[model samples]
Target: MDSANSKITVLYEAPQPEEYLQLRAQTGLSLKSLDGAKIGLANSIFAVILRQEDKLIGMGRIIGDGGCFYQVVDIAVDPAQQGQGLGKLIMNEITTYLDIHAPKGAYISLLADVPADQLYKQFGFDYTQPKSLGMYRLIAL
Candidate 1:
């Protein structure tokens, strides 16, 4: 849809923790504790999203130590906005930031959720299998 008609805009701004939580829930991403979200979002290097009619339609963020490690995280789009390329729009902004800022030899990584990995591959992300595997644990609250 055309901008004049859709009024969708992408911005390089981090959503407030509440907005982030809402988008995560709407987009089927796992929920985060409010306290954890505050610390995590405070440390994010970059975030981008699409907004339509003042509603957050999609969002993504880069979080890590500035130089050595960066993890692409919290990539999400409103269910109604999926298939509209909003996810790619989010990734393009994120990778552009990385190209400009990440140091040479810096390790950038993400844990893609099943089929979503296919979307990431288009942007040069590869499976780490055989060489390494992604692992994680959820702390009991």
Candidate 2:
């Protein structure tokens, strides 16, 4: 997509509480009220939401325990809007936020899904190694 046709808005302001439902549904990122509340409480949660007028076209977020470790999460753009680089726009915003806010020695990480790995690599993310690994437990709903 041409830059002229697409406009990306980066908002440092808090995520709208109500939008969580739509975000969760669209991104397939499991979000509960507790998770929402946790995001609300964090001192370092940065989010970027892309909108075409009133419709939300894309969004990305960074969440973590705060000072030492941070994780990129919920990076999604509508499938219809894919290939337009909206996901890259969202990542750029998140990268800026981390660059400005995260302190030295901070460990930033993300779990990429398939082709998205190529995108995240541009931002300096890498796979875990022999020293450690990415592990997660399924949360049965």
Candidate 3:
């Protein structure tokens, strides 16, 4: 995670809507409509984006009410950029943000996709399964 290239630039901000969509699409994260991307980026409690060679290479976000609850979302790195600890780079930025901002007893949560869940665990995240289950229903619009 900390092993990312020293020269890579990390910005504590969400990327533009079009750039966000492209990075997600490239990284196999779910695609979002232009309007949805715009709104989501605007609403991020905190965000981090990494760029190299003037291209968006990775990003992550935190979203939720300012207090009590927060969810980690949209952690992605371009497929071509995967396996280089870029995801960890993104997570590192996110946890740093949370540590500075989230209050005591704050509930930080994330829907960790398989394999990636391993990455989350390194940052002190764990599964709630066999005791609690994670579930979701996509909104239709």
Candidate 4:
């Protein structure tokens, strides 16, 4: 978990569209179109990237309407580089940004998947079930 001990580097910016798609595929996240990747990445409210020797190893981003609503998305780590605490490193940077930039009334949220939900919970995220539920349906262009 020590960047100083390895070639790993953490950057406070989103990766290029191609890298985004590659990482998502490597991590088994849903594939996103190139156009969607470019537009979505450019619109990130906040993003953190992990790199090793100039190669992207992990990434996470926050996108929203830029006022009161925010959602964390695109959290992915390269399969070859998993088990090194990179995911936590990305979340640390993200939570730091939110703590400073998010307004007092802002409600930041994320849709966690299975075991990954455990990681998000460490950053103060909680499930809103019974009282409310998360729903989604994808559309194609």
Best by lDDT: 4
Query: Tens-digit lDDT track for model 2 on 49-136?
Result: 7776556667777878767999987787877778878888889889988999899999999988888999999988888878888899
What TM-score would each prediction reach against the true structure?
0.93, 0.78, 0.91, 0.93
Residues 4-110, candidate 3: write the lDDT tens digits. Answer: 45456788899999999998888777767899989999999999988886678889999999799999999998887788888888898899889989999999999
List the pairs of residues colliding in candidate 4: none
Which digits, one per residue and each the tens of the lDDT, describe model 1 over residues 28-134?
88888888888888888998878888888888999899999999999998898788777888899899999999999999999999889999999999999989988
Of the pair 1 and 4, which is ahead by lDDT? 4
Residue 23, candidate 4: alpha-carbon lDDT? 89
Please tell me which model should have the higher lDDT, number 2 or number 3. Answer: 3
lDDT of each: 0.87, 0.74, 0.88, 0.89
Give the per-residue Cα lDDT of candidate 3 at 90.
Answer: 87
Model 1: pairs clashing at backbone N, Cα or C within 3 Å: none
lDDT of 4 by residue, 15-132 (tens): 9999999989888888889999999999999888988888998999999987899899988898877777888888988889899889899999999999999999999999999888
Q: Report model 1's TM-score to 2 decimal places.
A: 0.93
